[model samples]
Target chain A: MITTAHQKIGTPSITTLSETIDNETSRSRIPGNTGIWVGIFCVLVEFLMLFSVYFIARIHNPEAFLNSPDKLLTIAGTTITLFLLSSGYCMVKAINAIRSDQSKTAFRWVNLAIILGFAYPIVKYFELSWYAQHGINVKGGIFFGTYYYLTLNHLVHVTWGLMGLIFVSYRTVKGGYTSESYSGLEAAALYWHTTDILWIVLFTFFYILR
Target chain B: MIGSAEKTWFILMGLTILGAVVGEAGNVGWPLTLSVVALIYIKSSIVIDHYMEMRSANQRIRNVLRLFIILVPMLVILSFAWGEEIRRFTTLS
Candidate 1:
């Protein structure tokens, strides 16, 4: 018996095949797509820079930071924080539901998330009005300036997140997301969660730690 | 049993209220400050882990997010502790 040494060069062995598949699965463990990850990175870097500035300003003007929180309405901050957390939790449920292929449940969750998201700007609107009535605008001092700058910057991002949520909810209702193909939905959820994370930091800095 | 994410939401709510109560006390001494920042750290972690689903993510991204949450609170502690020194080192005429 002659053993022919010819072997299929590119053919996958069971071990190699399983390893390759595991690698792909791990790669897919990233919650969203590459483009969304890049977007998330940009958002994170931008906020990181802003936070650095915040620390620098705090160092130089500790008094300003100390006095800033007292002037703020804790109720407003608390309301906003709860709203963000609730919305973020809804997004998580949305993703989890979609992963289980429960599109109806996911759609309901996404819509609930969006409605909760709209509460942020509404509370913000009242909060700003309170600031105005109290004569606490950006021009007040270093603290007010930093407060307005950071909070307003965060508000802009929230608006973007709200837009993303609205679009995602629309698609969710349209059966656009399946268990294996919810990258878009996940992308929006990721962005929404990022916004919520950023707001948590903002709330702590401005409202929690005096 | 309640879902994990819902459990996280409850924990976050508890922390938020705790922080607010401390802040509302209007006299944030050192111990209060420590607790506040710690709450900040924990809340951020819950969002990153449970909400964002970052636990099983690629190591690099997960590490980056963790590093960020840690760094922010650490900076808060540093500023509260040695702020004047940092200002001196950072100041330029």
Candidate 2:
């Protein structure tokens, strides 16, 4: 009977050790590369298209959409900022815990990160709903249309990030990631950070610099 | 970690609020608005490059990504600029 110690793949040579660790580090990845670059490109293109629509409308009637920066509330902006930055830190912490063999700690941190991720969209929901109630329809005018469209598009991205976090967290709890092999963790962390960075941009444009 | 993160957020939040206030067209002028936009763009770049860890990505990938980031925003703004020119021509006629 070949016990785990006798497993040829897990042999102790540094090269084998390196590959084994790398494999464990990223093993829970759902088959094939998630194509991290493609995901990044997708988000980039979406943001570009959104701005393109705004500029197209603006070009047609710049005077019509000369809006005062008043609809963006500071409270809403602060809430989102707090959640996004903290959630990113929590994800990093979770990765660190997993690397140190503290499975339970890793699980806890991932949960915390996921909770923060979920909270972001919820906060955005309240803010957006309020805007809608105030007769600020996305099609109300060029200004309202562009404003609502940009923020709502970003909210959708947040939803996707939250789901990804949930999946990654589940895998972490299942012992999919180890100190040596944790590519999935790296990929998830990268995704979460991208989401965080994108939100910062969204926040600045739609809220602070509106 | 919490302290550093919180401090950074506070600083950024303060700067953003100040920029917004100063950039208000009602108070400052169109120039300030443009300046604020510039600052926001710079800030966004920092978030993407640093916090997002794009700084450590493959060189080719990073270049491609950077090009898109620059070009996309410029194109959006260019559309608006072209529209303004068209509006002016119409007014002259």
Candidate 3:
């Protein structure tokens, strides 16, 4: 019997077949088209707009913006940094629990994530209170104004992040995530991570960058 | 991977506290300020790439976002330089 080499050459090559298989496997692995990408895009845009505002404000009033009280910034920074990162870490545990089909453990960690996030706004409120006492209202000089503006904007983001966590926690309690359909947990993790990461940026920019 | 990002966060936090201490130990002045800016750039990159998990993105996508990030600081630094020039020229006038 003649070998089918001639027919094989006429057919799509093995390399092409293997390439198709590889593509499908990679898609199955990550499933990037999930709405998590949209979350990432929103976060990227939000921060960029924020930095742009800072840039324009500084440009418009170079001299008047000096004299930041680093002490107030550091207090807020440290508190937020600790909790946001802790939340991210806790969220990883939650994701793992969901992946392993441990709903109770997943729910526990998700709650922890929410609690950590809830702490953020409280810390921010204390810092804002201190600023108010110091005559650093939202409409103060350029420095104080930007100080309040940037931080309050970030506070709003934290609020939104808290809402996301709360929703995720509710869903986890409702059996929305599992080893079989773990994308919800993955999506929530992505949001938690974004919040954590954005906080780091704010910490550095507001507290460290001077 | 998550653990690695967590470790990075710890390091960034440590550096932040250290920056605070340095700011407090003395005047925290321009040198410390410059150091903080550099540190912010480094830490923010880590956040964007690792925690945001954009490290594995397409290079073009990474570069575009990187450009945006880089430009902000550059503009900020330039403002200082231009501000100085404006002051000097006004004094001369």
| Candidate number with the higher lDDT (2 or 3) | 3
Residue A156, model 1: Cα distance from true site in angstroms: 0.6
Put down candidate 1 lDDT per residue, B1-93, tens digits, no spaces.
Answer: 797887999999998888889889887669877887788789988998888878767777888888888888888888889988999999997
When 1 and 3 are scored with DockQ, the better candidate is 1
Off by over 4 Å in 2: A1-34, B1-31, B72-83, B86-93
Per-residue lDDT tens digits for candidate 3, residues A62-173, read 5554446444567677777878877776777787688789998999988998888888888877877887787767676776677677777777767777787788788888
Instruction: Please tell me how candidate 3 rates in CAPRI terms.
Output: acceptable
lDDT string, candidate 3, B1-93, tens digits: 556746876776676577566544544346755665576567667655765455654455456556656765565566555756644544534
Query: In model 1, where do residues sit more than 4 Å from their true spots?
Result: A1-24
- Candidate 1 interface RMSD (Å): 2.0
lDDT of 2 by residue, A42-154 (tens): 88777767766665655666555445346556577767777776787777677667779887898898899888878877887888788778876666677677777787777
Cα lDDT of model 2 overall?
A: 0.65
TM-score of each: 0.89, 0.72, 0.75
Best by lDDT: 1
Best by DockQ: 1
DockQ winner, 1 or 2: 1
Taking every candidate in turn, the Cα RMSD to the unseen true structure, in Å, is 5.3, 9.0, 5.8
Name the lDDT of candidate 3. Answer: 0.67
Superposed on the true interface residues, model 2 gives a C-alpha RMSD in angstroms of: 6.1
True contacts kept of each: 0.77, 0.24, 0.27
Name the candidate that leads on TM-score: 1
